[model samples]
Target: MHFISHLSAVLALAPLLSLASSAGLVERADDASCILTASGGDDGPIFVDAVQRCETVVIPAETTLSIATGMNMTGLNDRNIDLRGTVKFTDNMTYWINNGFYFEFQDQIAFWMLGGNNLRLFGGGAIDGSGQVWYDAFATNDTLLRPILFTVYQASNVVIEDIKMLNGPEWINFVNEGQNILYDRINISAVSTSVNPAKNTDGWDIYRSDNVVILNSNINNGDDCVSLKPNSTNIIASYLYCNGSHGISVGSLGQYAGVYDIVENFTSTNVHMYNAENGARIKAFAGPGVGAGIVKNVSFSYFTEGNVDDPLVIDQCYMTNATECAAYPSNVYIQDVVFTNFYGTSSGNEKSVVASLACSPDGRCSDISVSNIYLEPPATYGNATYTCQNVNITGNAAYLFGDCATT
Candidate 1:
């Protein structure tokens, strides 16, 4: 009780401290009251100076802050970003293509990377990524690399809340090598005006991180709503409404030849999925020259779907020809996965088959349980159909899905 009182008193006195005492406030860049614009060259040196001198930096509302170049924002502490305006990047394709950090794993690029401690970014504002041009260009040119909108790289103890992210060029958000990050009440959407749609616009990709939580968000995008990428553990995603997505998925892993991926201890609950291709899916590539790993202790519960195809699916023979897939089954083992409390309506295309679990013929799946599933086939079609192969059923509450077609 005493410590709480003391901390409160200290916080109350924080605003009274003189700006000259600890650090100064630089609110202008060469004349404007509170606006800072970056000219052509690298913008790192200017931001480094501002962050070092100011404890709280405010980007005023009704202004467009242009970033003409890529930046590397690193090694800062105790800062608050009060973003109330639009931050838009230039559409200089050649400059951006030559710049930004490169990740060879997925041929990914990032415009700017943020890292530090006690960092907070919030406001009723938006960050715009000029995506339409990239969308049209990528339709014809597959080799063009579009950069991610925002990346949290090598940072900890961060909170991002109550913001709007719009029209990202590629993946909207990527969190890599960070822990203790929380995102709440954020809005994300991407739509292309042209015929060429936005491609690979994953809402959130958590890779190589732990202890992350994302709650109460809406995602209308082109790809996975939230993907627990390779090496993502201890993650939680709840209360999500996803549309036009590839569903909340795990592992297009085992694609790379020599790498091992591990995804464990994750949960995604209370999701409303609509107009998607799949729901609650786990896909692994099957081939002799593929990676291997273990996925265990994961659960997807309390989900409701509408007009979705493959409402519940697990295909170990992902993206491989049937003959070759049978010849070389997946080496990655899947164990201890639970899918419960799902009720939904399936699309009319696959009228008879609502759920399919086509595991590896080599029996690489074990202890897979399903219960309380009520997925109805198309209204005019016949009864629901279910297929399960090479999996050990731990328990099924009502056998809602009929007899398993075990091989």
Candidate 2:
């Protein structure tokens, strides 16, 4: 009790000091009286920036704004965020997840965001997501398909930089159907605990999007650190550091069916994976009468894996169907998959070989190649095996291919 009182007294007296002494629960505003500031009201006809308090603001084209939050930013409509000094959300909120986002509803603490566009952050600051409410709510609800950090749709040209997301809800950064998106110089970290320690918390999930670039980011999540899902195409990720999660994945494709399905032109290079599940995987379920999922022109190179589940898993015989246990040839076409300069460790029982390509008998995964691959497992498993009926391997692990000519 005395310590709490003393801390409160110090906080009360601390503001009398210089702004340099500012710390927690501190709020600052942009002042037009000192320098240049956006001029006007919130009628979509004004250029509002450099102010202290605003319920809703319309940032004019080619304008900049800096925001500090006591609660959160709600009702942020379409705006051009050309520049921002800094944006800080409350370390604690009434709810569990204090997401510093433009919510979908008009009320703060709501868990949805609708509009996004041309939002750029220059001068290196942060948009912190204190995902307390999201965490508490998801856990209580036991909702499987929950997203944590960001939820924006139908927006375009989103640029995020120099931010640190300490704890996320489910998926940290979800860029959907937006074009020319870049998440640069970002770090997302969440250490797993025994209870509720980050499950299915993928680092960056891009679905139905194009021309996305994720460069120089570090991720520690519970699921695929970087996942390129169905309808996500023409993507590139480089210089990524992943820890204690599923390394990086291409598909769990055909989850959302359509003629408009496929994730293409994807590349993951210069990656470092440690304490993770399968380093590189292409996962899909098996069923019948579903639309076809065709994946083509994907490449992975220069990666280091640490004891991943299956250094590489092509389980086309996914057990999504219980009754159809013998159901083979899930309509998705897995083709032109290549692995090169890949070095990694494997599982407890068998670590001999580094690649496992398990496909269906009828629609067996074909035209797959692995080159310059090296695996050193922990004495439990030895010499990774290639068991695809219609796949061809032509590298160091190729001589094990006794029936390479027939299929």
Candidate 3:
């Protein structure tokens, strides 16, 4: 009877032993380092435990940690995540829709959010969203809420560098209400292999953030390479190579009613745009019942482009009909904006129109200057054309935009 009891005890402990072995959780002699390998199951809980317990968490090479649930590793201090392997979120739409962390802006969700102080996530690994299913699903249902791949939410003094982000469902990296953040040497690509294209895959969207820097990055995506949303200030992006993007844009702002938006002190330079829709753009909403905003002290310089549709654009009457735009006009005021050192070839999509500065009818745009711009359309499209409306143009390239209309 004692022997039988011993065998039953061992049998009861078998599952625990299997779980510990599969988790591959190793504690080093220093006690500050934790190494995690893939458990081939739901690794989200294991990852969270390591991150909460250790100061330095390392995911070794050739390991792919699968996460089925959302991770919120926020409120951490002085953490280092050395990712030498891949961290892939599972393609379970129903699970994510119910379980992913939801954000109010744009009704978006996220699979993972990392917010902390003095945190560094690097080491040249990749974060895969497994976005093929989302891409195909979004093609059928446009209203489907797709989750962002990575988000820096309410964190300060963070650096995310030398990383590869693949196949994000929507925006890849979102810096929301963060300060002193730097994204350098990052590579992002989101392309669908199916008939349904990857849509709304912006490289980086900075909202309500200050003192952010994005440098030396390559983005091949569908939407804006870098966008400064409302209340974004003191932001700089440089040395970027963007392909199939919507340019380095500012302010698709003033969309919500009774809300005030502001994007100021933004600069983008040394950008090479290829096969894009716009090279440099600023878009704001118009018509009745919309919010008011201000875009101030913004500059775009040293941009080289090829096969772009509109190399330079400023559309104040965004998403509004011409009659409504002329009737209501945009409430947003644009001031102290400069575009310089632009050399590009337009795709001739607008025939001879290479640049269009269509501001609102009122004196809403001021101190606008353009200089050293040499853009040419295709040889078959005759000469390059620059169109302007309701704004006085100043600078060496001011003559490019013929006579300004006052009425």
Going through the candidates in the order shown, the clash numbers are 0, 17, 0
lDDT of every model, 2 decimals = 0.76, 0.57, 0.88
Error of 2 at 137 (Å): 6.3
Candidate 2 lDDT tens digits, 90-178: 32443333434433321223233433554443334334444455455556566433434554455566566666665665677766566
Best by TM-score: 3
**lDDT, candidate 3, at 153:** 94
After best superposition, candidate 2 residue 87: deviation in angstroms?
Answer: 5.8
Best by lDDT: 3
At residue 214, give the lDDT of candidate 2: 81
Model 1 poorest ten-residue lDDT run: 1-10
lDDT of 1 by residue, 1-407 (tens): 00000000101112222232122323343211223343344334455555555555555686566666775666666665666876676777788888867877588988767778766667677878888898999999989999898888888777777778888888988999878788887788887899998888998998898877888999988888888788888888889999988898887778888888888888889999999888888888887799887788889899999988888888888998777777888877888889888888888668778888878876698888888888887878888888777675655642654555544
Candidate 1 positional error at 89, Å? 1.5
* Model 2 regions more than 4 Å off: 1-117, 122-124, 132-141, 192-194, 256-260, 321-326, 349-353, 380-387, 400-407
What's the true lDDT of residue 397 in model 1? 47
Model 3, 1-407: lDDT tens digits are 00000010101111111224346654433335667778879888889888887677777788899999999999988787888899999999999988889999889999999998878888799999999999999999999999999999999888888899999999999999998888889999998999998999999999998989898999999899998889998999889999999999997989999999999999899999999999999999999999999999999999999999999999999999888989988989999999999998999999899899988987999999999999999999999999999999899999989887954
- Full ranking by TM-score: 3, 1, 2
lDDT of 2 at 126: 37
